[model samples]
Target: MTMSSGNGISFYMPRYDFTVRARWLERNARLIGVLKAAVPTQAIFSHVVVSGQTVGAVTRIRYDGPGVMVPRVFGSVFFYQPSQKINLCYGEITESATVNQFAEVIQEDLDALRDLGSKVWADTVANPVRHVVQVNIQEW
Candidate 1:
């Protein structure tokens, strides 16, 4: 089945192990928000960007839409705003879950997200790891 919720598209998989559930957030970034990399590798992860909206304590990013509770998220996760840089060391890193209607990220988490963004930017084309590179936000 397919459905649209919280700035993203949701494809629900009937079974957990028997199927795959996928949620794709368009460039909106608000749905999935930029998050700390959870690839089972990559040490020192952190980030959180809150778009133009300023959320004081906690901000709701993604909710019960599509892969909200599926696949499980672990380690330091980030929820960053689109078109913004990540800051991995912006704030204290932690975990949170969705409740009632949507998943919420605290301010500290947002700060951390910013730190990760900076790190990613620095480690990537911004610093030229292997070859000279340039980062264009609008183009990306």
Candidate 2:
């Protein structure tokens, strides 16, 4: 799946049924192989604030060489209480990369997710989002 861009960020994040079919199994294999193959290249740190107070920074994301490799499927379901409508979506149809360059990718994706959380509305379902939590990437 090709990652979508928003709030000036772009990267793949999959959720829903397809996540059950393919991506779920693939990531685990790497949990054994690639994760061990890679070593902590560096420590991760960042400072975040919501409404003008310093929250925290650099939460200890161990940059192990590169991220894992795996296939993925993703989607999001949004419920808008005001509009009385539900938005069901699936996209970015592709397997993820190996040698993920994770230190960079994680920062990018987390930002995108946070941005999305801000823009959408809440309704019956909790605006649920789930994607392949890629532990490794090969840059395929």
lDDT of 1 by residue, 40-72 (tens): 111222123332111111222223223232221
- For each candidate, what is the lDDT? 0.26, 0.24
Model 1's alpha-carbon lDDT is 0.26
Q: For residues 40-110, write the lDDT of model 2, one tens digit per residue.
A: 22211111122111111121223333334323222322212232221112333232322221112233244
* lDDT value, candidate 2, whole model: 0.24
Distance from true location, Cα of 45 in model 2, Å: 15
